[model samples]
Target: MTTVELPADAMDPTRDDRKSAKIAAGRVRPEPGAREVGGFGLGREVLRSGQMLQAGVSGDRFSPEDRFCPVFFLDGERHKKARTAIARYFTPKAINTHHRLVMERTTERLLGRLRATGTARLDELSYELAVAVAAEIIGLTGSDQATMAGRIEASLFATRVGSRNKAVRFGVGLVSALHAGRFYLRDVRPAIRARRAERRDDVISHLIDESYPDRAILVECMTYAVAGMVTTREFIVMAAWHLFEDDALRARFVAADAADQTAILEEILRLEPVAAMLHRRAERDVAFTGAVAAAGDVLAINIRAANVDPAAVGACPHALDPDRGTKQKQVGSFLSFGDGSHRCPGAQVAMAESRIFLDGLFAVPGIRLERAPDLTWFDGLGSYELRHAVIACTPAPTAD
Candidate 1:
């Protein structure tokens, strides 16, 4: 490790002191070659690896050849193209039309469960609700939804921290469940064939009728499943938690006269964005914030950092003050859904689904917090899982 000392007087309070301290101490050493970021390596080291301008790399991370590299699972040009094709279905107008019914039914179902129980765990509740609605939209049967969700979570983020024990065992279980879902899909090809023979209004029928290639259709279906299944679930729970933590803000949202939920949703996304970071590997030497990233250099932009940047959002960055009195504050030019050519196509659907879920959730009388949930995130997985949360929604007391 190389270190270079700098003058103590040159401190800038305007910048993040920790970030500045690293650069001042020459702690920003670049590794020899263009390298990957944030995968089994130290997050800081991976971030700094992109600082090397001299390293030679193929810059192929964004190419179709690297599609399975985890980074490209949600990044790169192929994702962009895939998004373009998929956007035909996920357009704002289309999502508004198709997802409204799904959201309503899902909200009612979840609220029904909550109404029966005085208190319930929002973590499992929201995830299951989101997955069910997503599965229905993507043409998966009700019987398949729970199994598919388990599989997707396992395959996507089952990680082992060390050489031993129960976390690893649980991860193995997750992977097994995920693999089972894949195995189930092995018969899906014939299932699709039979479904094509019979008439249906689901996405499977549409894919067949539209004559999309089998693989392309499958990928699209899975993308919708993961995007809607995981992301929306996180949004619902996180947003509810946000409301629970801040009573005034919750009241603001609850008292809103109309159903325009975009502003409220935007603030929640900006404040504690469930997807904390977005990954990209340089296709060419790209300049960002005065740093030159060479080809093949993997960069993880901290959407959370960017969202809370004082430069971007002004002071009191972490505080969830929704009354910023402007649209820009709500969006904050955040990379939450990503930016550039590969922004999330399902954003509208996500917002609408969250609104419907929240509408049902808030309708319960005397909703009270039972326990603050643990929101600690697991790295490597590109989503959030709430460890636990319990809230009580009892009937209000009658007037004397």
Candidate 2:
């Protein structure tokens, strides 16, 4: 193990400044260690090195069974096979063809309702859109949209059992288990039955065709549903908040075409990525920065810090610049999507959904935040939640 001494500036009062200071210092001595590596350059190197393995392989705190079979937890050959099988559904082309219309329609419906209602909670709308897209992709569209969305949210809430108090943790865990079981039985099991009997052009149908057991399919659905619903929901609100704060960026995003909107979406994701950190475990001895990581050592890649690393993004990395060129000659160099084999497979879907939703959202007249959202951070995996993100929209224009 190795430790790097921090300078006085590293003790800056603000959290963001302190993080930046640490990143600046780490760039000077990029080493593999238990402590977080901050800069995008350093973090990217660590992620792409192939020395680190998915942290979920060690055992997921939220669900221990994830280590065995979930796509998120598997490593090496198993991971490759599972990811490749499901990969086609998430491709840019596939999403555009099979699911893009679903996303667009969902966004239009939600935003249209918001425009009529005059005031709406952005987080709720985001969750609804995310659920609809995820559900449609997985062939779980039998349930009503709101009911399905609620079930997904409940399932996610059941996973947050990170409390210091033993009793509280135990109580939450028990409740979470019940909620998760209900979700599996009510929402997931029915979809599995339907898909198994009559396959469709969706992920569940693919799994059925492959003859995956109900338990395996349930786990996979849980993984995708929670990930798809929570991350995208948070990001949509975060991106909208950023746009609502800046007039120029908002105007540019509103007028940008799909190609440019994709770029803007990438940039927004870089600045306010939903995942604050990417966790990895060392597979063998590896030296990084000033530290030597031995086998089984866990490393937390500080995504927020790294995304703004000047070495990668270049000057004024902290500033939100949509046109910031890709770093190190790599497209989408930001670690918002992790690097290496474990990179998020649903990256394109999330980006496309966000772009489509924003297109519908900002299309309305006089769209503005009714109240600033209260941002809260939870313990498990550094999850960020937005509360009270009320937005006001004027009525849609009438046809001439």
Candidate 3:
């Protein structure tokens, strides 16, 4: 297998210079023939094709027996069945009817706290909001919002083991497993028991009605918690950072209604997707966009690059254009939540949470960035995280 040596900065999604340079090279060469690009390639065509399968079995980390194995890793009828069973919970109707109130309340509470404090870290506020919404949806009601958020954050560090030595990875995985077990015992198990005794409309209840084992239920909850909490938190911070830095965008977003806000958020996600790289493996020999892959080959789909591919997103793909006219003919289109069957079920939920949170955040007069945040990447997953996103806010005028 040939390897491609990408510059360190190429993996940092916020570093447009290096990322654009690397993407330019892919556009010119297209990774065809014997010049394979070490599993990392860009372009809409590469992602939409049927040659690749979810990268679940490509490594031992996601063995079939793993508790975290959800529909995301399954294929064919198995995947379809699992996704079908739970699809209703994430539909727009379900989100609006069941989860919307939770999101609004959580956002209001957090923003109120920020307004009172006058200075706060955006990441902390975002994380709290995300955890509250996700926890409620997953039926994790035993723990307070702050405690659940801390546990979820600690458990997510396991994802950082991607490139570590086997010994270190093993240690990290062990610690992560223990943390997850504790979270399940403390927060999830009680809810699971309650759901079993009397079913509800939440995800935990759904899992019980489906007859999932306790371990599997815990895994699924963990999966949704991390997916919902971490990604949404990062996107919230990133979107706010962009809006705060750009007065025109902020003005437009603040003035626009919820629907317009959704579009603006999609555009921001298109530019700065939280998970910039998605891994997939070939199930059999395949060729596309001049590149050929044998069975069992792993490919890293550069989501950030593909989202901005000129051929796909049209002129000035890098620019943050909420009104960027949709081109119907594009292949991959937007991959912020990925494409195809394994796409995130909580896409709508994440978007809703972001819109509600931002709506409340920007409504506070004098709310502005206290300092610029530093964006860092976890080499293990090609994902970005923000630090020190301090925001200064004054309490909104109290009603008479």
Candidate 4:
């Protein structure tokens, strides 16, 4: 180990590096005549930008200053109020209720198409399935769902890290897409308006009828709809592809009974966390593991790194071994959903929906990863799109 000595003035803590450290930890570093000590950097800019809205929530919580929407939307007394208002819609109970319908409908409809045609891009198909399920749950029409999905896809690529120079163009594209989506939303506004008039039994109708939630708050929930639909869709495809590509894993997965599903899901989440990193900004000074961070410093938690940390998981951290251990043993260490107060509110719903769809997939005979297409992974985008995934299903085996 190398020993380093600090300058005599270092204790003053007015230096820039110390300021950066303080900002990185979400705390205020001492600064003379400075409103804030932190300097702006790529991390801070990206973290504070509107981009995190598309990033999805984590399984764990960040500092209060680091929380992002809709988690970040509230503070103190109001936080409880907002959470209470939305809790019923997102809770495990509510999600479980929606599972059978969404799962069955999606699988039957999609698999029917897949079987009819022998092969297709499973990734795109999965995305469509998730969009349909989410739209239906949130009371959007088929066309509305398609439009939303298209726009979100474009927006995601547009906001991707390396594309900053094209941001304006991306912004215009996303805006145009969202405008089209708004037009679609507006087309149904009359229905929402009518529901407000007649009190129809629908989720959007409920939102419309409720006098408590403001229009902005209601619109913000649209992000939730988009997030739930898209992230889970990508996650499903990615997870399935991982299993299908590895024969041993798929066999292990198929052999596991219903009771084993939970463990399998956790292992999948652990091995392939959807969002590899989370971005946040410090609203105040904070400290973490000896790092002092100041206000306005951008903070990023390496989810992929943390999940695979040898010390955290113990033994063969790199492999995807669902049966490696029991489910109870891996809870917090698994950063799949995220951490802390800003953890994913839709995780249970996403997981249930994913498992159900996967079950249907495994049930299909001759479902295999056919046509090894060129594959590339993008960490920034948090997904991998296959050049092709040619799959064909055989007729179910005749009863012996």
Q: Which candidate number maximizes lDDT? A: 2
Query: Alpha carbon lDDT of residue 46, candidate 2?
Result: 75
- Cα lDDT of candidate 3 equals 0.72
Tens digits of lDDT, candidate 4, 1-400: 1112233323223212110112123321222222221221232233333322222232132333433334444444445555566566666666667645776787888787776666667777777778776666556553455666766564445334344458776766676566545644553454455556676334565566454243433444455655677667666766676667656556666887754665666676776665555555455675544355566554565555566555566555555555544523656326667654456766776777777777778778777667654454544344443445666687443456
User: What lDDT tens digits, residue by residue, belong to model 2 across residues 1-400?
Assistant: 1122234335222223111233233332212354677777667777876778777322554342443366777677777888898888899889878889999888888988987778899999999999988998888888676876777667656445545688997888788777778777888888988887788888889888877788778777877887788888988887888777767677778888897777877877776666777777788998877567788887778887787776787666655555665433545538888888888888889988988999888888888888877776643545567778999978766678
TM-score, per-candidate, Cα-based:
0.71, 0.85, 0.84, 0.70
Worst 10 residues of 4 by lDDT: 15-24
Q: After superposition, how far is residue 231 of candidate 2 from its true place, in Å?
A: 0.7
**CA lDDT, every model vs. true structure:** 0.57, 0.74, 0.72, 0.55
Q: Residue 327: error of model 3 in Å?
A: 5.6
- Score residue 86 of candidate 3 by CA lDDT: 82
Q: Supply every candidate's count of residue pairs whose N, Cα or C atoms clash at under 3 angstroms.
A: 1, 6, 1, 28
* Residue 136 accuracy (lDDT) in model 2: 86
Q: Point out where model 1 deviates above 4 Å.
A: 1-81, 142-144, 160-183, 186-191, 198-222, 257-260, 325-333, 395-400
User: Which is the winner by TM-score between candidate 1 and candidate 2?
Assistant: 2
Which prediction has the highest TM-score against the true structure? 2
